[model samples]
Target: MAGAQRLAQTLAGRLDTTFTKVGTPRTPLDADWQAQLASALPELRQLAETLTLRLVEGHKPLAVLPRCAAALATLPVIARHHPDACLIWLDAHGDLNTPASSVSGYLGGMVLTAAAELWDSGLGSGWRLDQVVLADGRELDQAELALITQYDIRHLTSESLTPEALSQAIGNRPVYLHLDCDLLAPGLMPTEYSVAGGPDLAQLYALCSAIGHHELIGLEVAEFEEQPDFAMAEAAEALCDALAPVYERLYR
Candidate 1:
């Protein structure tokens, strides 16, 4: 929660935008796989509120989809509220796991599929798959690869996305960017769950700047563990600074 608050503060300070901090409840359901999710319901819903507060009011006390689903739910409101918005999903894994298929037992890994509705869930029923663009994704399982191929979702693999390629792919869509810090190479950003070998800092900044040239609704940086590392925080602050101007152009 402190991490999220810090991120919000960083964005508000860098972009000169309004930031609202909401509190979430702690659920004590269980430590096992599915039940652990229920425990996070209150906090997740609070996050959902934070994501969508610009568009609507009222707290819906439900277990929202972990990360991807949360993003999916927020997108429609962003699109409706700011119709020109597009989505850039930056992660190491495709995050397209269903309950039956997921071997890791991690709910965060399943977020993308839930948002895509490739997985069965009542929580993320609101997102349309067409609005999303996958960028810098790697380490996809076979089934997840098939799903991405089946959907024909536009994705640029970490190896393939030169700065030029990334800029062209974004192609002037008003973007809502979701950055899971794991997309960076492991040593550079050790706080994330992504595999080794990804774009370097230069490429990342270029991509963010390119996408920022378009209208940007909101941005979310997820999957940072609470351990404080000056290097990690500095990287995050730089990324936010690069993205701030684009955010300013859109919201301010």
Candidate 2:
């Protein structure tokens, strides 16, 4: 929780935006737990009143998925009021699954599905699946893979994405890029819970450039743990550097 707060502070400071931090206790993926999560909706809505700068509580990987979906559901409405908006998802997993089909039963893995409306009963309803761009997911389950294949969503895997490919994939969309620190190589970003291979620094920079040059509504970097070998502060700084140019152009 502290680490996420720090990251949010760092990101807001670098981007010259305000940041709001919220917290959620770890909960299981049961009916009671979902109710516990649903209770936070009011606070989430208030925090999202204006996107200038805000950070809500996110913990427990599984719970984070539902929370993210719920939050994202509000975005399209926000976008309707303020049109130009798109979503860029950065992670190691696709987060696409229905509750029944989730083998691991990890709710975080089902976040994208909620956003995509693949999940049966979570996340109120928001943008269409076409609005999201899954960036740098290298690990995916068979079920998740099938969903991606069926939807034909635009995604760039960590192994296959070059800076060039990332640039092309994003094209020119007004974007809300979500960076799950796990999308970095294990050595580079050890704070992440799961580290399957991810994009290198160079590719990441290129992708950020594309994102910044295009219309970016906002950005969210999640799932950064504080580990002995990991320098969360340094990683945050590097991310700020990568995004500096984008802000420069946007503000210029």
Candidate 3:
């Protein structure tokens, strides 16, 4: 059981979502994000299609994904209908690394950069840099930092993640939210990447509540690892307990 599935299923029990397993792509693992995308794009394309169908049919998606690269599907699909919608990316890292800049070459790190046409991901770049808001991004790579300065993308630090502040930043524009659970404090939950100095659960709840007002287009969560101590469902419940208000607002 992967962490994503466990977290998603647990979240489903609490939120207004139906749990469906979107299976993984089976291909020889490539060295970096770009090579991986190139190798498994065919299967990933099918995965995107499924998400697209559900979205067009009026489903508010709660996409639980292992890698942020899965946002390759979510971002483009949501942008198709709501081009003007602001994508509020809630994560610890910038995830803005381009192929030329990424030192680690992690696929998740390059997802949004690809969506912004910084690189091609075969799914088409439907999102623009200006239409994105990066919140709670504290642990940024030097390459990501340069890109931010170069593009002047909107980013909010942890202190500025208040609902009032977000509402002011995103007035009258509907929003698509992506959560990488590592945005929470390292000891708070299990995630692939654990950077120090993340927000606590209370702050996460407040951020979600604030975004609820922006008319959530859809939401996707990544980076949540399966916990060994608590049951997966229990961990999900504890971690997402604060986000209930956001779910109620969106699902209601």
Which ten-residue region of model 2 has the weakest summed lDDT? 57-66
How much does candidate 1 score in TM-score?
0.79
User: Candidate 3: lDDT of 53?
Assistant: 89
5-69: candidate 2 lDDT, tens digit per residue: 66667756765766544545454345543564476556555444434232122210111222343
Error of 1 at 247 (Å): 2.9
Global lDDT scores for all candidate models:
0.61, 0.59, 0.80
TM-score of each: 0.79, 0.76, 0.92
1 or 2, greater by TM-score: 1
Q: Kindly list the per-residue Cα lDDT of model 3 for residues 154-250, writing each as its tens digit.
A: 8888877777887787888988888888888887777768888888888888878778877777778887766677366666887778777666676
lDDT of 1 by residue, 1-252 (tens): 455555566666764655665555244344654675665556555655565664465321111122443453454445556555466788887777778788876677776666656665444443455556778778888877777777777778876776577667767776667777678777655354758787766667777767757655556666554456546566557656655545555555
Off by over 4 Å in 3: 25-30, 227-231
Model 2 Cα displacement at 248 (Å)? 4.1
Using TM-score as the yardstick, the better of models 2 and 3 is: 3
Best candidate per TM-score, number?
Answer: 3
Q: How close to the true structure is residue 181 of candidate 3, measured as C-alpha lDDT?
A: 84
Can you give the lDDT of residue 57 in candidate 2?
26
Candidate 2 wrong stretches, greater than 4 Å: 15-18, 23-36, 39-42, 50-85, 120-123, 247-252
